[model samples]
Target chain A: MARAIPTRRRWLLSLLAWAVGLIIFFPILWTVLTSFKTEGEAIAAPPHILFFHWTLENYAEVQQRSNYIEHVTNSVVIALGSTLLALLIGVPAAWAAAFAPTRRTKDLLMWMLSTKMMPPVGVLVPIYLLFRDWGLLDTLTGLTVLMMLVNLPIVVWMLYTYFREIPADILEAARMDGARLFNEIVHVLAPMAAPGIASTMLLNIILAWNEAFWTLNLTAAKAAPLSAFIASYSSPEGLFWAKLSAASTMAIAPILILGWFSQRQLVRGLTFGAVK
Target chain B: MATLHTRSLARLMMAPSVAMLFLWMAVPLGMTLYFSFIRYNLLIPGPRSFVGFSNYYYFVTDPAFVAALVNTLVIIGGTLLITVIGGILLALLLDQPIFGQGIVRLLVISPFFVLPTVAALVWKNMMMNPVYGVFAQIARSLGLAPLDWFASVPLLSITLIVAWQWLPFATLILLTALQSLSEEQREAAEMDGARRFSIFFYIILPHLARAITVVILIETIFLLTVFAEILVTTNGGPGVATTNIAFLVYAQALLQFDVAGASAGGIIAVILANIVAVFLMRMIGRNLEA
Candidate 1:
């Protein structure tokens, strides 16, 4: 049933596709380009499209003005820490639900997902007060725990979907071959599920890295991640467009690269496997 | 295939996630419910007295609440409309065999990964600045005055930023769905002399129904709480023009230090979100059964 497309039609379609793509990508492209320009050039009358004196001065200034390294460290720790915690809690839960089904399994999974639907604002007061009472505000540990809780359901859901894809017969065969429970898991199941686990980790890190609500609310100085750090630029400080763009670009670059690599898994994780 | 021994092991394995999720859901929700019924303000540390429904009453009666409610609806509706329609068109275009398709796809999907604060700031300063922004430059080149986006139309501006962030998500999911459409089905319809519009309406649209619903439902949940975008850009400014329920609650609780009033607003937001959550849960529940 497959047919080759005509050359002219394909070329026309390509032109249209590229045009739309460029327009959609223009904002980010503009930001990256502006990051290399001077403050004056960034806000020039006719915005410099391509021809501009590029310099690393903005990047240097952004770093000199703020503790960029501290924020990046916080972002890394929170994203990776929360992702690891979620995986630790999520893997076992997903393995159980995927490998051993009960009447309540479906209901339990749905309930977990419904928790995600509960808007964070609904619980903001209690959590904020609790954090205050316990002196947990502006601490990396507090944020890590919160992010883990926020992303736990998605982690479990994605892992469950991935684990279900692995045939039960293979596990049965391992069991029949006199493999012990730990050996079967460590030797067979882990290897089979490695790709799924990797993608889930990638997606969770990206999510936690970019999570704004809690990070913005709970963090002030000591534990602020890049999200909050970049938000501090909202109050303009004397023609700092280039510096802001530089900070913004640095904050988002790592996650953006990871996101591109895991585009397929993103649909699966966010949608709870509804689309895929 | 599940034996009793296996089921017991499974229960043991599922305990940690289940227990934590239960506590996470129940504890704060119960506290919010309790707080909504009392007179509690962080600023005044007097003995909190039980006030039945007064908190909710005052919160609902506030003029800002009405404005926030309307802004929330508008932002959600506007973002959903733009993302879904634009997603469909983009998906259709990308479905065509094109040159450098990989690079094009990468370009289109990049915005979804941009952090909200970064996206909002980039839009506010670099693109929407009334004086020297690209939009201003374009308008002036054509002999027109540039509009101050946040000052004039704050909610719509926030909606545009949120939509740009989400459009990539919708397009990617819908395109995945579109790619899964069977080639034989399309060829059969074509062999029957179906026009392009007819094929789209009769075949493609129905196939994309589930993906579209998923996009709408997920987007709605996120859009209802459009916080950081407004926070970084407008801070719900220009006379509360862009304050959604989430931002209003935040202002009440954090900025104004009125805990009880904010808790009441929080409860209202929960109920509104649950209305949408019910339908989405049903759809996903049905999918699970299938």
Candidate 2:
């Protein structure tokens, strides 16, 4: 490490890293691989590490038994619905705080974040009561609203961080070019901020998709997303590992792909830009 | 040209979010506080008279309260211990110039994306199922009796699952911090004949302290609320053996339908979270000023 000019040491380090990485990743890999194995093979004594007779029966059976598509659609509606709504609210607030240097802006941002700090359980009783009274319990609309508010602070904070980085000169020139406020935001501001907005959206979707507390407590069969989908399998009666594996694999696949692209945003968004 | 007008316009832009967040925060929280001081259980259906601090007193004095509080600490403490120490070691390994590092990073961070319920269920059924789980199979293959994970060491089992989910987060953040260390700093240390341990303790460890703190605080915020994992695996099993304060409050509110008592516990969780929030706010607030 001090002076890296040796091939042998480099090879050894790579092997060690790969070995550890594989260990850290084995559970996920095993889940995915098991999705293709039969129930017996899945729980085989030696445990088929990969050489099982691969089949799509588990996937088909998972869909047949659980209506996987409905769960998938619910997840999309809740995750994207909440994320887009958060953006609808978050983007302008971020813009206002970023472009305007009001003395209270920092306080405003901090206060928004403090809303996030209020643990879900703290308000669970009230929210649950309210939802029950309003007939909003176990509805996609209800979950969307809850998820939006749950992640609203993060959405605002992440968007603000992105918006603050947009150079002022472009907006200035657009204004000088006789662009009205509406046109300025539509043409000039939107394109420049689009990447940041997109990043914030992706991150929020990831958060909303993986949000377990509200998703679990609030929804039942109809409105439950993938979080609840997998939780539904927690107490399965018998010989369901293959199906559980298949369902888990499908539930995480979309978000996992999305998550792969949002690593940088994750660090920034969660940290509230603390590290950077 | 029109500063006051634009400032008001800016205020208008931020108004909806702030108002909604305010309403979202104020209504339920205020409701929780109000219920905390009153006698309100869905099942009991009575005059709903004010109970004063009795709700709080009963809740704190409940035998489950102590166990839950201790378990909460164990989850946070255990997860933090695993993630931070494991994270530092992993970060060091990852920070090296290695082949297929990008693939390795992906493999490492994949767990962070798995929903808690899914992760817990998968771990419980597939890996820790004592009867057919991989861990059991491995233990049996070694001629050792399979340990029933949930029946024994339930908290540690949940802690391991939580740690597995969060280890990637710790690794990624710590690795980000580690990469920021300048090579010149290390080379200079080497020039001074500092050994690998000296370089690590002196050069790397000091640089990573802030990141480690960030990891700890952020993880603590989430870990204190570890509900789904516990729910999916043990259901706070073997008689409140794995129940943390969150699940305890949840059981009180939902299972027992004791709204006032659960509200009291909820308020305590809020207070506990707020104490942590104060620190996080100060730290981030300082960063914002800079």
Candidate 3:
């Protein structure tokens, strides 16, 4: 197993791997390619792969048809807003648990984790009624708050995992060097935890961005993010293939790019650092 | 480290998250519990009264509940079977000495990042459409009939789509775990003259056991609540053919306006999830101690 593989076998394996990878990624590739085609070309028999009249018309038409900018704006706001809020609330809790564990802290951690287990459906009716009665429905603030709460446990869990890896010795050394509380955090802890924090934030933003259930149920015209906005295309529309592709491509593009950068964190974060 | 001041400060820091999560869990849950025991319908409002267990009775007795329950299990089981097995094989492939590893990994992992709504729609319209879809095209090219994915096998179609998204996740975690298996250990196994199949079962699968459990537990929890794919594609049916527990509760509340019945269904779903959650919590708790 340690010896170098024969060149022929390597070539064959590489070819097989590449084939599988392309097959897995074909749907996304097809969508992006279809976005550049005319409606007719999108569904053309013996569909065009690269040889087609490529145009930017669908991108423009999609925005005009759906006010796609509004949805994009909403997606940005909700994803960013919820992520920030989760970090704000999660960091301290995670920090406390990681650094200062009491006998009850384990129980407390367990309790927080249990909250994550409570299926959203179990609480859907009351939350919906509350959103309706309190006039929080279809508002960025409401959705942001809901998203924040929805993601809070995960945020805290991920942060706790990262924070646990940080040795107390470094902070103690910083303290011995006459660093104050704020200075120790800013100068010492932040740098050590920065990558993990960035990963957590990126992952949280992507999750919130693509969140569909509450977004579809809670929003209509006003607060609809791209997730809900794209659902409108589900109903039959005339010659909408290219337009749909364009919309989907835009909906996923930002997150897709962000996701590539966060692949390392995806495993760590989703596995709760179990694999790492 | 355990000084009173630090402990107090720790508690203070932990307060907001705990309090918020407590309120989030309690208020809606309490309200759902209350509603589950009473008669409430948004359509026919006014004069609400207690109707102990009747809502549960009706919700469970509804034929849709049985279908939704079975379909939910199918999705959870089907996706788990596909993703876990497929993931192990893919992880093994990616773990090999291959060129352009990064790009191939990028391609493989891209689907996990796609929005469920977008994935659902793309698969429905472009990949699986009976007329003019890629699969249809492939079928025609092969001189075979085009299979209508949603019309014929809605749940299986949903499972395939969901599995496609989750496969990357399983593959990635398993790969990470695989990479961590030291070369020295593998080389030692080779020196001991273990066969390839024996080496994998004895050394590799055992090493992957924890990671596999991690994938299964997390994926099961998430799969239990698959809503967007069904909502966009089948809207829960060619006659409720694809509705799962989450979608069922959703239909009861939003579509049908049966508040009490939906609350009952929601509670039942919660109960169903707890069975998995118990194992998950234990796993995590063990990890914490470790």
Interface RMSD for each predicted structure? 0.9, 1.3, 1.0
C-alpha lDDT values of all predictions: 0.93, 0.90, 0.92
Candidate 1 lDDT over A104-147, as tens digits, reads 99999999999999999999999999999999999999999999
Off by over 4 Å in 3: A175-183
Q: After superposition, how far is residue A30 of candidate 2 from its true place, in Å?
A: 0.7
Task: Compute the lDDT for candidate 1.
Answer: 0.93
What would the per-residue lDDT of candidate 2 be over residues B61-90, giving only the tens digit for each residue? 999999999999999999999999999999
How are the candidates ranked when ordered by lDDT, highest leading? 1, 3, 2
Steric collisions counted per model: 0, 0, 0
- Candidate 2 stretches greater than 4 Å from native: A1-3
TM-score of 2: 0.98
Candidate 3's residue-wise lDDT over A112-174, tens digit each? Answer: 888888888999999999999999999999999999999898899888999899998888788
Comparison by DockQ, 2 against 3, better one: 3
Poorest stretch of ten by lDDT in candidate 1 chain A: A180-189
Clashing pairs in model 3? none
Q: Give the C-alpha miss distance for residue B197 in model 2, angstroms.
A: 0.6
